[model samples]
Target: MKTLQASRAPRLFPLRLSFRFPLAALAVMGVLFFSPAHAERLKELASIQGVRDNPLIGYGLMVGLDGTGDQTMQTPFTTQSLNNMLQQLGITIPQGVNMQLKNVAAVMVTATLPSFARPGQNIDVTVSSMGNAKSLRGGTLLMTPLKGIDGATYAVAQGNMVVGGAGASANGSKVQVNQLSSGRIPAGALVERTVEAAVGAEGTFAIELNRSDFGTTQRAVDAINRQFGAGTAEAIDARAIRVRAPEPQQRVGFLARLEDLEVTPTQASARVVVNARTGSVVMNQAVRVKDCAIAHGSLSVVINTEPVVSQPGAFSGGSTVAAQTSQISVNQGGGAIQMVRGGASLSDVVKGLNALGANPQDLVSILQAMKTAGALSAELEII
Candidate 1:
């Protein structure tokens, strides 16, 4: 009996050891198969070519204001529009009788009709005064037919205006905040028509990237093909990729899964943007700098003028005259040459620029000079 027990214990130990080895190998493989930290979903990097929003605009009238409407005398179009609306309502105004309206203003209503919108969906609208009106506050937009670029009515807008501005005036003094001529109405328009969106009509569709890059386009195509199957996607150019889609009945579901797949995009190119008017400088993370030297200084010129009087000497019948004397001075500040070390990373570049102790305005000039001398690897753009 003792020998049988010993033989069974030895067999159990080998079995346990075999199980442990397989488990440890699985954990290591799982870590290596995971996606990278910078991977992003395909939806954020690209969109379907034919799916987009359409802009709709219409001319409308806003009423119910507190003496802040357009003056009919200056804006004759306002009076004409009012008269036309009145005629449509079966109300007749006497000829040669001018209507002095103070509670109505002419406005332009605008809204965006999103893709896949039905006939009854609601959208926000913006009303802007087209005349010289004091404000559009406390006013309500009338029924306006919003039209698309093709001259077709797509939606109807009518709602109370919500102006996020205020102003008061008394004794010829006034103060105001924000804008008073434009206001927004939340969900003020109802879609009356639909814009046809033809996607995958030919058994295929296209993906358009927000920014053009050959490397990103190729990677995206590869990832899509790997997920679906070989020959599923093909690169058309740096900005577009064509993919074979399933039948119409299964197209939506297939796109839903396709957009969720993750892929790593190529790194952005190095670039720098400078605002010339505001003296603002912005640099991206990919920007790098080569070894260079910079010297910055300022030059100023000042002028002074004084009035001089000359009197007749000992009443010699000479008239007194007034003259002017002017003085000018030029000043040049001392500028010392500074050394900048070559940088491979964004942090190193920033530290080297900061070491010069120059203001943003001066830094703009220095960067321009560096670009000209071939010391800056990034493109310099002034806005």
Candidate 2:
């Protein structure tokens, strides 16, 4: 009919290009076989020893402070915490009446509590400036208490600080920005006390681990005995692990389903860190090395002084003098040897230390001369 429908539209365009090349190779083999890896959960890698965070502290008293407070006669503990809060409020003063408080200051506060935190819940304190105050901005904080580290008194704080920074000086030039002697109060304390925590009482629980490996604590005790079964968890060493739980009324739904399972941890060792004041370097994917050959070059000296004002010709009696001159210069550079090869990972030792083009402080002296010639295999640290 129209040349047989143009030969059946080129045979249905090769059967829709053979079903779009096997659905684009099954979407690239489902992204190279399901791609996952970085897993997590086990309650964000462990920590159940009575779930933590107590800290607390206290001391308080920050008052108004428009005059940048704290000079209460060279901070004699801000006039002895304002004569012990006016003798615990009975206010009897009148003795050596030397209270020249330009607006008070003496702070400290702090906070934390967290883990199950009950009593009245609030927590957020901070405060700071314990003496030379100079700037607690528009203060307030009075109530105080907070304690903990065994000194008892769980929380109390007080509020109104929030000083995110600001300063001024006048005749001596000054212009501050963020952190006018520390602040922050929001939800200023409260939690009165409750740190008991017997976790799962006698059904056994443990976990711990926030880093101590033994192959990530035996792969989190075989992913918690393969989701609770074979002897239901164990390990107890390279940072705890124990387990067995499930009775204190099913231990909070068995630790909320064993801290959402997931597992996969185990893979840290190789190290490399090196931040000696920001030349950074990091390395980790089990950092590897071995077959090396780097050569990187640099040298560079430079000097240049110059300062010659010696005019005496016009006067003849020689009177104007001042002379100094230096030049020096070295440079060096051009070395290039680079070979690298052996590197079982950490991106082949960062592509063989970026093929020796050095830089990060000359790749921290070529990875401390490839870890003093043993051809680096990891653990260098430096911090």
Candidate 3:
């Protein structure tokens, strides 16, 4: 009986061990597989320094309006521009002949000439009324030369305006939706020139970070060097990284691969942004707060007025007197002091603030006070 009991005890021990091993293995695997993901591609963090869009602007006239165009008398420039355009078209208006046109509005045409844009490529343009035009709906923009800051024509814009608003006015009352003075023309400008992007000249180029950070720059350099080889990339500063490229023909493929490499950026600084006009409060994950006491309350004033009339007796030969009686009252709400525990994380900080039972507008003031008192461990920015 002793031998049988010992053998049965060993069997029971093995069964219990086997059952617990699988659960322990599963817990380790779950941790490895379900950890928080934080890796982001290089392209999201930086951009090629020289590759950017250029702004182009032009002045032109919009015709075919439904009597909502600029008043020529009020905007003399509109009349002068019309005369010059007519003269160029060989339709000479007699001198001193005032032409009252109600369908022409002067406008400013604007567009962005993208990088690597070649000749004959179309781009969208925005047309804005520069005069007292009631609406720019249903107007045709004339051929206008869009020029860059260098005073060189880069594109020509001409198309029908597509206004997204509707407005009607009658009997001195006006009802409008959205905007009437500005409209967009889809694919209205033809690119006549190309802006050269000097990237990777002399077998090297620069990657500029959107925000300047030394840790992020060092991490990017290290990631690039590890992927390509030692001494392949180096940090110029906190915001720029210089990288060596392969041959000119292979540069594009190399850059495509480089942009895909994943990098984990350093944790950002704690910051709290408050929009005073909108009563908005936003904070980053790194925000924290020290143990503090806060007391918040609201004060309101009420004014009530009533008209009182005093009439003399009938046939007393006295005029009635009119008077106003006003009663003003002030009320202050109770605010109990609350003790807030020190917060080590963003969630804890939020909980501590929520305990004060303050609205967003009130929170703005509270955050400002906490920052002044050195209780809030974050940069407070009011916009």
lDDT of 2: 0.76
Candidate 1's TM-score:
0.85
For each candidate, what TM-score against the reference? 0.85, 0.44, 0.88
Candidate 3: clashing residue pairs, number: 0
Shift in Å, residue 165, candidate 3? 1.4
Of 1 and 3, the candidate ranking higher by TM-score: 3
User: What lDDT is reached at residue 23 by model 2?
Assistant: 22
Put down candidate 1 lDDT per residue, 101-173, tens digits, no spaces.
Answer: 8999999999999999999999999999999899999999999999999999999999998999999999999
What's model 2's TM-score?
0.44
| Stretches > 4 Å off in candidate 3 | 1-37
Residue pairs in clash, model 3: none
Cα deviation at 283, candidate 1, in Å, is: 1.5
Model 3 agreement with the true structure over 202-292: per-residue lDDT tens digits: 7789999888999989998999999999999999999999998688888889989999988888878878888889777777767779977
